[model samples]
Target: MRRIVAALGASLLAACSTPPPPERGPAPAPAASPPAMAPAAPGALLQREAAVWRAARWDELPGWEADALQHAWPALLAGCARPAPGWEPSCASARALDSPDANRVRAWLQQRLQPWRVEAAAGRSDVRAEGLLTGYFEPQVQASRKRSAAYAVPLHTPPADLATRKPWYSRSEIERLPAAQAALRGREIAWLADPLELLMLQVQGSGRLRITEADGSVKTVRVAYAGSNDQPYRSVARWLVERGAFTLEQASWPAIRTWARANPAQVPELLASNPRYVFFREEPLPDPTIGPNGAQGVALTPGRSIAVDRRAVPYGTPVWIDSTEPQPWSPTPPPPRPLQRLVMAQDTGSAITGAPRADYFWGWGEGAEDFAGRMKQPLRMWVLWPLAHTPGDAKPISTR
Candidate 1:
């Protein structure tokens, strides 16, 4: 089965069967029809069911020429591996180039693709060109192959009767109920020393584990999202904020982890604040640099892969982002820098919807964690559609 790819980085969470709640940005006023004007030129108004794509010149994309297209080449090629409809010819041309030259890549893209400014379609509740941009990353945590006094927290596979149990068990009940425990008994894939890390794993839906086997051998592996207990997802960070543990603006993952450490006695209660429970399936991690496969069934390229609303932007399409880097987690951090760049629409999340919204993938490790944890910013997007295909030829109407 294809692996589940989901998340809304920082303090947000998503997974199969359980997606994070809709991300709410400023509620823009509904768009009004423009005053009578001359007919739009051919290829000007490219309309999809949920979005309006206005034909745009490449020059309109901020920082388009300045971007190092070579860095984005691999992600473009990766998306080509599972070419979306109308992307075959472009994919064929891309694979034939086989060169990583920045100039060549830039020229190829300019020659083969057209830019389209994305906006929420008229008649939508909130119609605007700007939208929310968040970030997500694969987490790396320590683990043990077998249960031990130190590594007592077990990350399990789906319960044997997960299917028949309807909503199965809440996170709290799974820990306290005998029936729930019995159903999950003997299903442990690995054990972690920290329950908060386990929660982190569950929230991200998938993560990397550096495991110590009984023989003292250490190796790394990936835990992919297998399934989830059917339950409503509540934000634990919000839970803390409501209880005055911290202000909502101070609810970064690092802050949460610090709170967990200082309040170890309440860790279980904190974990149970949200009722959702996620299950995992372990897989080999032969290459540490490559990321887990996204919903597109292709290994994601760090920094270049973005999770988008497939209803607005088709999978495999190249997107140009005009946003800023996340503000630092420090109290007196400097202002954010411009983060304009080229990215690919290779994945999706429950919370990621709308033409202009996106979730940037920051890869893995400590640095990635810091960046992704604070990456909620305003954004604008322009899709690079293949010149060979008209907007109508692309399938962004519905995934169903």
Candidate 2:
């Protein structure tokens, strides 16, 4: 689950867990950790390209003390690998922290960070804190090196002339034309059985392939984003809604898959409805437990990494997000589960454009995919900046 760049243009991934489930029993007394920088006090209102930030006390953040931040420790450390401007001092101190205790981590953060409530810029009017939260996941699909009855669809590397042509062939043209097919001939990295899964992989921008090689050895590899055909992206989910296949509220991935099964003949047409096509290049997977690299160039932590607009929140910043888990649309929908917790801003997405918007990273697997697919919830966020620097002194880290 990297910086997917779009929620509707391309779906962001999400998952079920948040901050490793709070530590059981009462919180212990703060334990001593490595020395940190002298805490600088927080400041007042600040403005960014599309957001407004108001300095706030930690108590203002919901579940601030309740979250077991030890689970978020890995993500914090990961972000430090490429610390943003004004983050060097904090990152240095963070690297010295060895304890995984909830109280200890909490104390470290409180000592060195300032919480700022994020609000959307409302064009010379008041600021609004509420924003959208979506989820993204790294899809894991079974694949084969060679085409077979079970694995017929091909996932390819970039075509030879992919860059020569601006806005290359549409997905429908690629599937329907021989010249387009010829350009991709013998370029297949692996073949998959379910076209829908392949489409999901493309939409998600990256995936894990459990590939059976031609020599009969099987290994899991990551198929990362190489390039796209540069076509305009259209949402298949929206297309389904327009065609009366499912209502807007019911257009989740599961529902789409169900509709595909019932109307097998229409599956191709349904998939082709989204003209955008993505290409991939496989990478070696040495660590299965670790997640895919985000836009920050660090491996994502399950339930801990988030995709945010760089304009509002810088990469590597710790964010305290207050939101509820995805709720069903049915009459008997379950109670709203609180999704408040500490997360790292390590990625960004295309649809993740304003100050309040975010795409939660759910890591990988079927459970992640399912949860991420259904995650479209209201979000409120607070960015934790290093207390040592004022908002005026801190600059957003450039990914370009």
Candidate 3:
């Protein structure tokens, strides 16, 4: 019986191991490999360090047909004065343009330039087309040549030893230290009534001052960014939020001013939260219509000049922006009111980083201020390059 049981178990194991009958059908063909990407055309200027550069057509650009190209001519001319790499041909064509007609400018650009869409490189963790667009403008503020009962806040020029020092006196030190104050005693370019205005001027890096001289003669002049103390910048608004005094959403300039007015004793502490201080040099207003000098060392054109990351987009590069004027009251994003216009990358800011981020330069005065203060919008950008110019040996990979 034991022998029979063992034999039965062996038979069961053999049956379980037996293979099934094969199906009556032909085998499927081997999976094909994906098609290889096409190589870049000859003479393409590829920024290998950047995210990605994909060739694009003018027709593909949103609102291209509707943009007033003539309005950007002055800015184009200004950029030509300090042209970026491969911009010589385009700049020459721009310089030769005699007509200010929108159609003419549009035709000229269409003929000479190729638009390229900039996007995040493949395998990048953050891959997106949309970015943040903010606004900056030249502020027009009241000032005086000499400090008085009302105009107490002084705007100082950079000291001779500014370069020699690793980091100079901070906002609070300049106000409290006798030696620091002595270094800037005779270097007062102008004085303003509100300390916050002076702080804002420093933050903006440049502004137009409507001044009343000691002799009571009035004139408007520009105070351009001369130097800084080489210290890191700290935001007072962030400090306020960290201290639990106010939320981040309630840290607007007006809100801060209100807080300062209510707590006059803490004003100094509030101002001192920011360690960085900027110095300015007075400049003549050659063209009242044109804005102050930007980082590209040319006069910025209203609505056509932008500050971008130099690492991503070189200075003087033509950038097409697709953004909208922000609506502060709306909870939902407003319709894509296309600001799909040509703008020059002529400036940069500490806060303006990444490939797509930009700071649109709105000209001067209260209207500009209002626009700039309220402008933080979603944006997409395209860089326009000369079709005739291209990288010598490097092959560009098609992102599409």
Model 1 lDDT tens row, 166-283: 7989999999999999999999999999887888777666789999988999999998877788787677777777788876556667778888889999888988887888888888
Q: Backbone collision count in every prediction?
A: 0, 10, 3
| Superior by lDDT: candidate 2 or candidate 3 | 2
Task: Tell me the lDDT of model 1 at 117.
Answer: 82
Over 4 Å off in model 3, which ranges? Answer: 1-45, 48-51, 120-125, 242-251, 330-336, 391-400
Candidate 3 achieves a global lDDT of 0.68
Candidate 3: C-alpha RMSD after superposition: 21.8
Q: What TM-score against the true fold does each predicted structure earn?
A: 0.85, 0.86, 0.82
Q: Candidate 1 has which clashing residue pairs, if any?
A: none
Better of 1 and 2 by lDDT: 2
- Candidate with the greatest lDDT versus the true structure: 2
Model 1: number of clashes?
0
The positional error of residue 385 in candidate 1, measured at the CA in angstroms, is: 1.3
RMSD of every prediction: 8.4, 7.2, 21.8
Task: Report the C-alpha lDDT of model 3 over 281-310, residue by residue, as the tens digit.
Answer: 888886787677777777788889888766
Candidate 2 lDDT, 61-98, residue by residue in tens: 99887898999998998887777776776777777777
